[model samples]
Target: MYALEKPQNFHRGTSFSLITRNGDDRSETSDYTSEDEGTEDYRRGGYHAVRIGDTFKHGRYVVQSKLGWGHFSTVWLAWDTQKSIYVALKVQKSAQHYTEAAMDEITILKQIAEGDPEDKKCVVKLLDHFKHSGPNGQHVCMVFEYLGDNLLTLIKYSDYRGIPLHMVKEICFHILVGLDYLHRQLSIIHTDLKPENILLLSMIDPSKDPRRTGAPLILPSSKSKIVSESEVSKDAKASCSDLTKNQKKKIRKKAKRAARKCIGKEEADQDIEVSSPEASHRDDKSNGEPSEEKSRNSVGENSNNDEANDASEGSRGHKRGSRSARQKLLAEVELKCKLVDFGNACWTYKQFTSDIQTRQYRCPEVILGSKYSTSADMWSLACICFELATGDVLFDPHSGDNYDRDEVALGGRYSRDFFNRFGDLRHIRRLRFWPLNKVLKEKYEFREQDATEMADFLVQILDFVPEKRMTAAQCLNHPWISVGPRQLAPSMSENGGSDKKQETDEREAMEVRVGNMAIDGAKNGKDSKSMASPLKQ
Candidate 1:
């Protein structure tokens, strides 16, 4: 079929009527069995493709193609013809149809973006907002800069081969920058931080590329460049088949160019006889340094690094750098991490009133029924930071059921695994919300030998007591977070030995207290309901 070619004089700024010569009226939604749809719908189902050339203008942004949709609004890949760039359009299905939670989210997003300078940059930029009438009613549309895949996609495609340490750090640091902006600057709380929400500006490499390492970048061909307003108007009037073919060709060319570019200048110019062997050896050595760290990070696999790039496109550049340079780069990264997502960040004092993040990344404070603030964000930062360094999540539960309600209502795996490891904590000190002894017996059958290992990591962070959990600042000082002296744990004090010991002791005590409280409540009639844990949707 021949594509409809429109007149070149069509201006983007002017309003134009879109006449449908042929309309295929079809609507079939797959409503799953589960009623809860916070963010899991995308995972459980497929996203609907927008009708090609069906134009919807929101202020300066003209809706192009539907990218994805969630509970509150539908996300569209759009063009800001005036700015000459591609942007994400989040249009509300209908203003009147919005739930109270959805309305609150919209207001919170606006406040965070427009509230503080630091917060503004951390969030996905809000370019414009407008009202449009859908078949149902009036809708609210928001425009944002379009980003590529999220962290989850990057990790899934990583070939089960871990991501480079530096790249992991880069992603974590960037997220922190955004988190800090939200918690510290704007006093907002994200309540949600997971692989899905973390979007990549560009694809480090195509999903099919052979080279899987090196600096992250987009295939030049895949790189979105602004099309002229006239061209966009003409194209918007074209048919679906025509647009799909153009997009495919555009992707293929970009992939080829990306492959050519993957041939590093150093590797490309080296002597053919020995260079390949030498280069391979160097890569191995770099990979060697982070092995232990990677294992520790992988224990849970909460992080999904496949969201940002495809493993098919491997690394090609320098692997490890000098300690000094690495430290400097790490510091610079920590400083810049304030750029990722600030629209819904919260401070230590802020209470995260809404369910915003993915299940795993949600902090224990958020999980247990505690008020959210910077501390909660710090927890998320630590999780992401760990993922960056090791390519894994810290406490991702294996079972699919919502652990929050299960833990409270039925006292989950702690019945078997926890007590079996820690032995009966009957003789241990009073924990915050639980009965120390009863909980030990009823939950994880605590063994004497299990206490040490159990007390070491997970229990400390997932303390069930929000106040007792470590803050991101505290995590920055932990050995797991640091590599060595002003070298590894640069965020910590090397010389303040006694002070560090005291702080550690205090944290330990807090953990014990919180544990006791939870167990005690379980034993008694008192409510141990925490504000940290979330209600399953």
Candidate 2:
């Protein structure tokens, strides 16, 4: 059905192979006739010993090497032999997660693709899906655009220095764009946004062509039409230098350009013609200089400026053009963050209410037993933002009284930290277990002051009551993010740094239905989904 070869025309190690498939018809008789001959030939050719080479003859894709592995799926780097392109084949294993997981994955993929395809850059593109019967029974597979490494590795290489402020701005913009699409357009909350899940469009390799790699790769232009792998390696090396005066100057210039572009729709439309006319005049004047004389002068000036600005902003309108691009990337990250381990995902609002996020990132409302909205995503975003900036989790309670999982699960770090910080646990209610005194009695030096201060700082975000947790829209305007501590990264000393709106609508609707189901089902004397155990559950 498919063939694999190390094409002579292409480089070794990794290269494309051709595959051909007929229209849903196979010569069955030929299969029988060729079986014996094929087996003998396969043995003679040593085909059985081929390592890291396997083929899956789907409609048109022939999946090849295993590219990655998740808990429930294995992704293969595949070839759309008919189209002559590479793709990723995510094969769903027959694990417990897959029996029911495929539906959710497919639904999210299709939803993201069909809903505003133009804004779907952040989300992986699903090209096809197929089913095959194997020794274990039937299996499912999905094909997506092949992406290289993820942001996590990039962050790792940064040594937790966090991405540069300009880069962070770009990253934030992309994430927000993706999130805005998901929340408003798709009515969904990513509910999760971390480094690992955010992937780069190009593969992370020093040997990859610059034009074919990274979120900030240079576009094809007159200066260099084709960017080879060596050029990318050079760029990466240059990017490693500490921020110099020249680099800062270049960054400021780029920032100015970016600020102009983001100066609101009214300002943009007003200046569109004005700026273009002035720029056009400047280009025309510059074109008439004596070629040799101009070239000699240009070398000194261009090298000095380009070397510094290359890391901060390119000659490309990356500073200006990247605003929308960044938003799209952020939106993509937010979307994938939503498609995480559903086993741990709360499918409804009520479930989300009862089961809050990890203590470090939990919104104050959740801590105080107040209501929450899709805006709860803001709290998680803050947590991740801090991590990206500082390379350390904001809150990981591993100290004080060591409580087991059961104790932590039943009573919650909220209850424990609540009393520790507030000097009383009486304000908390509706927990499955734990008396007020017992909760307070867990002798530990809870960082109540720290928690309270942190919460107070985020108060505009997560109010003491659930109804008050900041919405994603409100968060966009929050002082901390827009102009406060989060904003410190750009203006403050190298020490500080800062950092979605989505999944609110669908989550609100989902929450309401789930809540109603719980209420109505309770009245009818029916059991809800079994209350999972604190420890085992």
Candidate 3:
């Protein structure tokens, strides 16, 4: 993914194939400290085998740099000659079997775009889509507006410690907003919701388009549009990515000298810079917690030690004082995020698999072989929330899984706790089940009220029966979320004010109920539908 060969198009012993490396900006280039020792073992037709600076679709877009890769495709940060800006190009794996999911994704994205153009409500925007033929085979390609690194990367940049609660709340809130839009407005099921797919929105200033200034940059296939000098440097680094290590160092040195000359400075006094916008791919070997790779080539690690130390202090202080110092930074930065990778997404009207969700996030309904709806997505969100909060999975059943599966480590005995609630699945005696609040208190060290509130919210969504679980809309409206932390929601406030007059009428007219059927039956021999916690009116 990082190379800088001199020839416009030449093969390298280390690089995968012949690349058309053209541009020559290296101010942001880092010296090569790591080697591709095992890259030769990759198959010739593999996704990572593509050369840098490769043009596709009649050279409408020029490959700039490899953004990252996935099991089914490799993504590159490419320059759009047509749009005069950088964009993300995803090339699907050569295998045609993966085509079905890609096509489905395209359809879902288009439908979502058509439904709500303004719904920057928190879903990634698909700018364009097309296909390309390569020696391997015909590969489907997608174009997306270049966005900042994914949440997994950001978490690593912040170190393995849990993020401040305010930032975490905002992130989770944005996720729920996106989920609400998909589940309510589009009726689309994400199927997958993990940190990897949660990406921060664009970092580029949208108000400025670089290509208006005329510049004589010649190319046969590419139709060069005039762009600002700042962006020019960025695109140049992408094209010259195939240069050798010494070549990169020399080029960078010369560029810095030229920059210093322009400003009449004797020397470039800054540390070697990494101009690439993308952060390093997350270190996946840490069981489940995210960690940054400390390899010399990794971006962002060397840029700032003060910020890391500050974050550490801020996190500790926030824990003690109950307010995050970085909350304003998150808001000011407009740190919006969106869900990507609709490859596994399916329409509510169309069903793909009876089994859905990654194993750890799987809801009880699917585990019990019962039919599931969008509520399955809700379950996954609950699991993701727990993971984000505690840096651990909530309900992993396997020892080999990346998330912690042992409940005893979480301070609870799983068998004793769950058997009472789910044991009836085997058609045995139905013991009284433990409440979610009790479980949270036992399994975690959170404050009592905090545990109670979280458990209350989770309990509504984690119902043993699928039909009883809170829907996405219900989740959005839950007091724990909508009420703004510890404050009471206006509608649920004690005063029977005019604002809540209608709500009070409806609620008072509504009959009050309590207890699950099993508990009620055990006490009074009455079979009844359970009433979860009352809405705090």
Candidate 4:
């Protein structure tokens, strides 16, 4: 069954075809499901040159598998043979404009790396970058350390469930630290901040690969369906057998020529699906790690593929569907996450745009066409925190004619209070705030205390005025985000640690003030549910 097969390069770049003869070789082409395709399929419509077994940079990294597709780039899980590790390569489209964008990102990443020496906090690390000439075009590829699932993947995998509170705090804390670093130290703003951009630091102790660990990570939200070693061995052999059979079946020379004629002719450009977790699963089945709904609980689930399944929801849809409004909580507690994408990142003095954030997480100032600073990121952070705590978008405003239609229907449309970013309000004293406490308590069933503190924390940033908004540094110092497990410690000072004691007193007093504030806004509770927070000029 020996046969010769030329490398199936998909990109439009310089070709260095490696033809190899093997006894068995076959590959099935997966239809690019727009949702789960590698990043930016909606931006650039075409086939890329990267393929399974494709080696780059003198065989430093060999492609193991594809991760997902995007409009701007396609991601692949490649093995760093030179370093004896796995890495994710983001292969940009060969288009010049996109290549320019990739270069911008590379410059930003270099700045970030040079700014932070030890990787002290949680942020995706960029490893390497180079250009690869392929069939589609000359692709500028950026390499990243291989990571596990994004937060969205974790949520969807839990049967569309929300995560635990303690875990949420942990995840949010790390995100704030990263955001703080970006906003303060780096003087950069991450224009795109969503679940898809926030990746898990690792499934286990990052150094060890999950595949080599011999144990799969089980989410507390969904009980793990562990497969015995024998079953996994059987499935592996079956998959390999199927691959070899397909590879050995030769494509007629005429068929190959016909296929070449249609390369990059596929139109997969569609609006990114933001709220639906399982919406694109059917469309993505043709690609790697195919799974059906019925076999969803099957054993030997590849975590990397699971990440691909989740990355499609990165569009950051402005509306959380009615079905996803209610979410059951997971039981896991040890959660860690890191912010990843920074393609649109710009300096604080020079922002990319006044409209820098995703629709769902856009701040009031941005929506009102006001000048926004780092406070804009804080607003997005607050929205993300709410989603993490409730498993739903906090301020989802539908698009087109339906935008803010829900609020208008409930007599809660209060856009008149918006300021024009120039300190001129549409109406003074006419603006009303639907207390965040009631939104959390009534809508998501958060405890009174949790709701109060979180509302107090969020309100300070979700303000109409950017000047009134809380900074990332202030957020880190807030009692809600700063508070951790209380423990009895031996007195460092014989005087009963007066400074520590004073700090505790202040924290407790702040907590009391937070509760009082929520109680004061109890009258606004009536409008919390139907009230709309999302508005656009």
Candidate 5:
């Protein structure tokens, strides 16, 4: 799940809600679960029932609010009393399997934190961890540095029109940096890499950020009652009550339209089901002014007509100004982000499951039941880059024949299982070959130069042969990623050559390490092509 907190003003309108979901952490009953983590899971071996004022690890971390929840764990926004700062507290379920997963995640997080002492690896940092014994059972709680919204929220803020090319390049650079660190230095593979797992460093809106807004931390109180999920939902609704009816209606319409564009038809249908009548009623009650109240205030309507007209004009100006301000904020947003949610991550030689990665980001080799390595993550990164550029998934497979729409007939250890000797899919007869460049130009209206550059960078990583896919370090040096202003590595002139020399030396060292791995794989009867070979360059 994502390790970040949603702003208090955020509402669940789009299907791409900021709620994080690890690759295989979702439970079977997730389809029918409520908006919140349901009460059904608050049993002896289930989720620890967390309250607003609850304190964990002997009052070191104080729960402020629920950040999000997944089948494996629940994340909370909490105050770190020891450090006097906000943090994300992830409380895992006490079930045996969940406990094992937590232990694995903790081990990976510790390695990451230890390796990146300067915190420049673009991965989330593990702050503190402890076991909390609750009524449910002893739960493994992990504390992480509190981050801002995920890339999904950033996409929504852009109205699903997609961000600028420069911004996309900036975000891609950061993601590749993180992936390079994981794949090269730590030998870890983030099995799941998607927009939801990448988070910005700060909130999009300054007013909503606790640090920026000088918001007071919620102190622990013995008299405070446990806040139920229903009460939390009500509180979220109340926060948006001041929005005008027309404004709320506009938001809903935009959200539904964007949801349809973002998610597949089946997922969209599920979202429609989950948006029940009771939820609509709550929205209506919260957003609409009551008729009785309007009638009672009608006595002064005539007298205040002139004042109302002036107020209306002022409101229009304020709305225009607000729109401009929001645009400015988006333009000035820091593009730096970090890779988060390592629950499904595994080392190159110690994979926990064959079924890794979410459906949209799953690679061809995995689908074909072949061997996978760090290259699988490169495929997912390519998909995410496409999504960030186009505001839609690179591959959105549906049921039946549609599921093989993006499948390519490539030679692999298990290729014969799904493909014929003549290089054709056994089950799917027909195929439409639309190259990445064509898809961008014809479908998304990308300019020729932009389409070609993007296709060049992504196609290498999206190669059917896993061993031939570009390494993260190679991708970092790609021309497409270097188009924008360099943020991760400054120029020699900007830093008096010392930092640049160090950066270059590090990149060279990583390439050498990757080359050594490739040689080792080749010696073990793998492909002759080195993973560090820059296919396009």
Candidate 6:
């Protein structure tokens, strides 16, 4: 077993913090601090400062590393002593509001777990929950089965080029099955559905997985006294006082320069669109790297120049090969995923908040302040499908002047709510109509057939009227989903079995492929319609 390092600042060395919203519509503002949850939150009624090798619940779970941190809680990768497995341990803040939110989430997760005893619902399972007492306060800690990277990570692994049509179908099948179980079986509404909320069944890269790598478990060690942020600050100040004035001046200048560089990089990155309409027009070179042509022109015809050219070409070839390998690996991945982060879920009859869903996936009904139901989730699902097929978001509305123009394109039943009698938007009179199919074909360069099929499937779910939107069960049977790799082939028995046996085997295979039990054609109901609707006006 690896010995635990000395307990220093617990917030150091963590990469980007994972921000999980608790279904609040209000925006939050914070000062730029460290990438991890700021040190200020390490106090009474705040985040519980966790250290590696620290055990919780009578040494049942040993902390290994910080997974991520959200506004309400800090998630850690822990080794379960009794279970002999790795688990995600979520330690929520001890504040009253956060505690209440944790209780609500626990209730929802319990209901989900109880409904799906076999764990076939494609939903995250809540393994255990208990109270953890620490120097900060009493925290409600939840233990969950450790899953792999989320859908957003999968998208990144694809280099934002979007997954193939067959792979997208496979992922969509799982998401729809989960949604069907939640909406049809339990009457629950997952108000917030996005790429970040869906997690793959296993890590895309097996080398990083502890279970696959046979990594030793982190064992519990002697407890160390927890240090508060205030104490750390005092110690820091004392150390600074011991330094010479000249050294302090140099340190201040270095910090200022580093801050400026950080701000400049952030602004530059914001201008670079990962997958936008203008992306095709931009050069295919990564930022901060010199172009091949530029590198060639800068070098003179010498032996050193020849070596540099060879090195550059080799590096470029290596990058290309690596990307190709990753795509191939992604194609072979199991494509199994589970819906997670239920901090905002509620029953259709009793919603926790009207302002639900991320901005990109928000339905037109929710934007127009109309009553939402299970169809709201369907709308979000449609948006996710489009994103998976074509790396760009369907609707990316901005604030102020551009908001009305971008939102009006979504067209909903509540036109009178935001539009004038003349059929013009009240806030912004000028509007531009860009049909979905046209946007996919012209802007994203999707093939005509692919664009048409994708739009037909999405438009049905994105209907202005919420009730007309396709249900998850109906989406599972959509023509677009049934085509490609998901298409069922006639069964041919190797043992030359009877015709009846072959038919039964084929039916079972179809059911397994779709990840749902109710595969009967009649179960789709009236929501399933002919694929003749045009996405373009």
What are the models' TM-scores? 0.46, 0.46, 0.55, 0.60, 0.66, 0.66
Superior by lDDT: candidate 2 or candidate 3: 3
| Tens-digit per-residue lDDT, 1-537, candidate 5 | 101111111111111111111233222333412335556777779987665545676556665556666668777776665566778888889988989999999999999999999999899999988888765778998999888767766665654545666778889999999999999999999988877788888877666666577665555323222223334444445666789888766656655455434323322222111122222222222212101110111111111111111111000011113534655777777888999989989999999988777656777667665778999999889878877776665554432333233343344655565568787656543232445675566545566777778788988887767898899899988998865445434222211111223354564565577567657776888643211111112
lDDT, model 4:
0.51
Give me the runs in candidate 1 sitting further than 4 Å from their true place.
Answer: 1-50, 95-103, 115-121, 206-357, 388-392, 398-405, 408-464, 468-470, 473-537
The TM-score of candidate 2 is 0.46
Report how far off residue 17 is in candidate 5 (Å). Answer: 22
lDDT of each: 0.38, 0.38, 0.48, 0.51, 0.61, 0.59
Please identify which of the two predictions, 1 or 6, would achieve the higher TM-score against the true structure: 6
Question: Model 4, poorest ten-residue lDDT window?
Answer: 290-299
Superposed on all Cα atoms, model 1 deviates from the true structure by an RMSD in Å of: 21.3
lDDT of 2 by residue, 480-502 (tens): 33543223344222322112222
Q: Where does candidate 6 stray beyond 4 Å?
A: 1-34, 227-321, 400-418, 483-537
- Tens-place lDDT digits, model 3, residues 241-317: 99998887676666645643532221122121222222111211111211110111211112121111101101101
Q: Per-residue CA lDDT of candidate 4, range 356-466, in tens? A: 565556655555555667777777787777666666655544322223222221111234433344544332222233355755554344667766776777777666567
Score residue 199 of candidate 5 by CA lDDT: 80
- Every model: Cα RMSD to truth: 21.3, 26.2, 19.6, 19.4, 19.4, 19.8
Looking at model 3, report the run of 10 residues with the lowest lDDT sum.
Answer: 309-318
Best by lDDT: 5
